[model samples]
Target: MRVHSLFLYPVKSLAGVEVSVIDLDDFGPVGDRRWMLVNDQGEFVTQRKLPALARIGTGIDERGVSVHIPGEGRFHLAPGHEELSVLVWRDWMNSLIGPKQASAAVSRFCERSLRFVYMPDDTFRRVDPARVVDQKRVGFADGFPFLFANQASLDELNSRLKHPVNMRHFRPNIVISGAEPWSEDHWQYLTIGQARFKAVKPCSRCVITTMDPDTGTKDPGTEPLRTLSTYRKTQDGVIFGQNAVHQDGDHLSVGDAVIICPQES
Candidate 1:
C-alpha cells in the first residue's frame, strides 16, 4: 500500500490542513493539534458542541500558527504571557493562553468566549495509560497521536450509504489507499516510509463523523456512522479507523510505501 494523503490539524477540532510531507517530533506530526480552543472555564471546546468551528480556517507556517474567521478577520496566533490550567478530557494540562485580540476575534465568530491555548514544549501529556504503557507524549489530540484510515474501507462504507462521505469527515492523519475494505481492523503493525506505528486501538465513531468537513452540517439521515454501527460496532463503540502510536522515525510523505503485518498467530 501507499500513503494516499497526509493532514494536520494545527488546532484541535478545527478543519485540518493537507500537506505533501510532515516532520515529526515526539508528537505525531510537527504542526498537528498543538493549539486548541478553550471556554471561559478553560475546558476544551470542539466541533462536537459547535459545528460552526469547522468553518474556521487554520494554517501553520515556519514562524507560527494563524486562524481565519469568516467576515471577522484573520489573526496570527501569539502565545500570551499568562499561563493557565486547562482541561482536555480527563487530563488537566498547562497551556499558554493566546493573545486577547485573537481570542476575542474567534469569540465573536463563535458568539461565545473562547481562548486559543497553545501546548508549549515545556508541557508534556502522556499517552492514555490504559492503552499505552510507554512514556510517549501527545499534543492536544484526543488520545493517540496518529489516526489511520483506509481508502477502500471508505469506499465500501460509501457504497452502503445513500450519500457518500469523504475521508475529511473522519479526519485521519494518514490515508492508505491499497488496503482492502476494513483490512485495517486486522492491522497490528505497519511501516510507512521509515516511521513505524503500532495499531493501538480501533477508533470509535462519534457524531462528529456525521458532519460535513466543509460546511460542518450534519447529514440529514445520520449516515456513515449509522451504517458503520450496523456492522462495525465493537465492544469499545461504533468503530471505523485505527488509533496508532508513533514508534520511531521523524518523517513521512505522501506516496510513501506502506508495509503491514498482522499480529503473529
Candidate 2:
C-alpha cells in the first residue's frame, strides 16, 4: 500500500490543512493540534460541543498558525506565556491562554464564550500507557499522536451508506491506498516513508464524525455513523481508524510506501 494523502491540524477541531508534506518533530506531525479552544471553565471544547468549530478553518505559514472564519475573515493565532491549567478529556495539563482578540473573534462566530489555548513543548501530556508502553506525548489531539485510515476501508463504508462521505469525516492523519478494506485492523507496526509507527488501538467513532467537516452541521440521516454502528461496533466503540504513535521518522510525504512489518513479539 501507499500513502494517498496527509493532513495537518494546526488547531484542534478546526478545519485541517491538507498538505503534500509533513515534518515530524517531537510530536507526530509538526504544526498539528498545537492550539485548541477551551471553555470558560478551563476545559477544552470541540465540534462535539459546538459543531460550528468545524467551520473554522486553519492555515500555517511563515507567520505561524491562523484561523479563518468563513465569510468573516482570518486572524493570526498568537498564544502568550500566561499558563493556564486546562482539561483535555480525562487528562488535565498546562496550556497557554492566547490573545484576547482571538477569543473574542471566534466567540462572535460560535456565539459562545471561549478561550484560545496553546500546548507548548513544555506541557507534556502522556498517552494512555495501557495501549502504548512508551510514555509518548500528545498535543491537543484526543489521545494519540497520529491516526491512520485505509482508503479501501472508507470505500467499503461508503458502499454501505446511502450517501458517500469523504476522508475528512474521520479526520485521519495518513490515508493509505491499495490496501484491502479493513486491513489496518491487523497492522501492528507500520513504516510510512522514513517514519515508523505502532498501532496503538482502533479509534472510536463519535458524534463528531456525524458533523460535516465543511458546514459544521449533522447529517440529517445520521448515516456513516448509523451505518458504521451496525457492523463496526466493538468493545471500544464503533471503530473507523487506527491511532498510532510515532516510533521514528523526521518527515512524511504524499505517495510514500506503507510497509506493514511484523511486530517484535
Model 1 RMSD vs true structure: 1.5
**What local distance difference test score does each model get?**
0.91, 0.90
User: How many residue pairs clash in each candidate at the backbone level?
Assistant: 0, 0
Badly placed stretches (over 4 Å) of model 1 are 263-265
- lDDT at 74 for candidate 2? 88
**TM-score (all chains, Cα) for each model:** 0.97, 0.97
Predicted candidate 2, C-alpha RMSD? 1.2
What's model 1's overall lDDT? 0.91
